[model samples]
Target chain A: MIKELLTKERIIIPLTGKTKEEILREFVDHAKELKLIDDSEQVYNRILELENIGSSALEKGIALPHIRDNIIRNIFVLIGISKSGVDFDSIDGELSTIIFFIGAQRNDKKYLPLLSKISQMCSYGETRESLLNAHNVDEVMGVISNWET
Target chain B: MILKGEKRILIPIFSEKDMLYLIKNIEKIDTEGKEFILLRLIDEQMTKNVCQRLRRDPEEYLSSIIDSAWNNLYYFQEELTKKEIHSKVSLKTGNALNELIDFGKKTKIKVILFSRLLDSGFEGIFKEKLLKNLLISWEETIIII
Candidate 1:
């Protein structure tokens, strides 16, 4: 299910963002550029609102920032990897290096389950290490493909 | 002071059986104009330890557990919807007791419905201590079923 939303085009390696806001904006802009969403500003604002409520940053250098709204026509996941982690206020007080920005239609039944899948994927130390070691988009895809198998 | 408004209820589910038990006994609770939050907390430390002991990938081991939990929670959410109960599902990974307390406090949950089944074994001592601590730490009403 995650593989369907996360394609090679959606993966960004060595993201240049230094802060959480910058990282989120980078992902939102990329989604707009890829024609995945109509308005980058609206999407970015909505994501920030959710972040204010609670940081999406999880433990072990991973963050899954997501939103479900009427504006989203379908579920889309944009993956961003940063070698230099950003402080995203994670529960474990660790920087987030891998961010999975997810947008889903308000009524999409797969929203929560998709988040669950991503969380499960990031739970492995091996998965995080492999993703960090990935040199390009294909390497990232390779890691995900290996996980799917 | 009497508080009269929408009261939110928190149900912390640890496994499929806990969800099933809640679904079976959901009718016992008053569901009028109440919001329910179904939460599942995955223990990261415990999972990592298990993976190390068994020499298994944490992703593979956690995936199976999380998938089953998600399925059960989705089913329980549907059942609640059928009865006109508005609910949200939350899946988190952290210290189970700390996460539960933090979530409950952050959401301003007025009540918590706990399944007695979860308190039985699978870190029974830890859960036993957690229950005791919850009663002591939280001002919200806790119903152990």
Candidate 2:
């Protein structure tokens, strides 16, 4: 399911953004560049609203910033890897190097399952290390495929 | 005083059973003019113990637990939205009782809905003593379904 939504184009390696806000904006902009969503600002704002409620940054170096809005037509997963980790207020207080920004329509049934899958991937130490070590889109895709299999 | 337009309901979900029960009985609760906040709490000690027993990394285990919790709560959120109910999902990690109390105080919640069967899942996490303490900790209404 994740493989279908996340193409090589959606994965950004060594993301240039250095802060949480910058990384989020970068993901939204990349989504815009790929013509995945119609309004980047709207999606960005909704993500911020959810973050204000609670930080999406999980333990380790993973952050999953997500939103479900009416404007989104489908579920999109944008994976970003920041070599210079960003301070995303993670649960373990570690910098976030692997970020998954998810956006989905309010009624998209696959949204939760995709989130669950990503979380499952992050649960494994080898998978998390593999993702961080991935130097390109193909390598990241390889890590995801290996995990899913 | 919770004004007519300011009333909010807090439903703290401890497990999948709690979510299922709440979705099944959402309409019976008086949710009119009130915003619903679905809260899911991850017990830190429980996570640590599980990780230690399984020989898993605590950080990765916690990330997975948090997301799995979100998955359950969001499914409930979607059901509420289908019923045209406005709602939000919150995930927190800590002592369940303390988190509930702190969240209630921070949000000025007017009511908290808990499943009568919650104790079955967490080895009596919501036992009589804790429930009584929760009742005494706040003046708001607590409905155990």
Candidate 3:
């Protein structure tokens, strides 16, 4: 599921930031460039909405920035692994080093299980460590690919 | 393989251990053909054995906060698959059975699965609540898993 959704087409590299907002902005810019979203401002608004509702920051050092789409046909996934963890407002309040952003259509019911897959993969120590050390976009993709299979 | 589907269950689990069990079960099951019933067992409170008259039950103090949390969890509309498991925590207000019936109607859920994991702490508190509030129509599909 992640392999099909997460590829070079949706990935970005070397997103520099020391703050959560800066890092999120980088993600927003990439999403806008790829036409995955209408605009970066919409992206910001989405993030705000998610935060206002509930934090997607899960257990461990992972945060899944997620949103539902009514217009899109397929699920869109973005993989971002930060060497320096960023605060994601997680339930456990852990700084997030690994992030998986999910954008899916509301009618696409397959998204949850795939999300479960991603989190299960991340739960593995070897897989997570490899993701953290990933140096390039392809490397991150490769890491995810390895985890999924 | 990734559990690929559109609708996943929204279960607001109370015990982390139970959540792990459900997650593991999902892993064993092929989710390619089915959707999920996301469930949430309202945590944040204890179902103590101390019970009293209807008006003095713990539900009075708890109904609001629990309902609020359940709604908050409901706002998570993110889906990764086409078919998935979905369930939710019971309402924090009114009678438990009635709350369940009302939520079931609103969500259009056909089944309500329960467990004996919780202590019968408040004597027949949960039982009474279900008897009083349960919709007569729901009797056919209630699953005690």
Residues A7-35 of candidate 1: C-alpha lDDT, one tens digit per residue = 89999998999998999999999999999
For model 1, which pairs clash?
A: none
RMSD to the true structure for each prediction, in A, is 7.5, 7.2, 16.0
Q: Pick the candidate with the highest TM-score.
A: 1
RMSD versus native structure for model 2: 7.2
DockQ of each: 0.13, 0.15, 0.04
Query: Model 3: residues >4 Å from true position, as ranges?
Result: A71-73, B1-145
Model 2 lDDT tens row, B97-125:
79888888876777887777645534355
Q: Give the Å shift of residue B82 in candidate 1.
A: 20
Write out fnat for all predictions, comma-separated: 0.09, 0.18, 0.00
Tell me candidate 3's fraction of native contacts, as a decimal between 0 and 1: 0.00
Interface RMSD of 3: 12.4
Candidates' C-alpha lDDT:
0.79, 0.78, 0.55
Error of 3 at B139 (Å): 37
Per-prediction tally of clashes: 0, 0, 53
Per-residue alpha-carbon lDDT of candidate 3 for residues B53-104, written as tens digits (9 for 90 to 100): 3344675434443433333333422321212332222223333444455555
Q: Which ranges of candidate 2 are over 4 A from the true structure?
A: B1-14, B19-70, B73-145
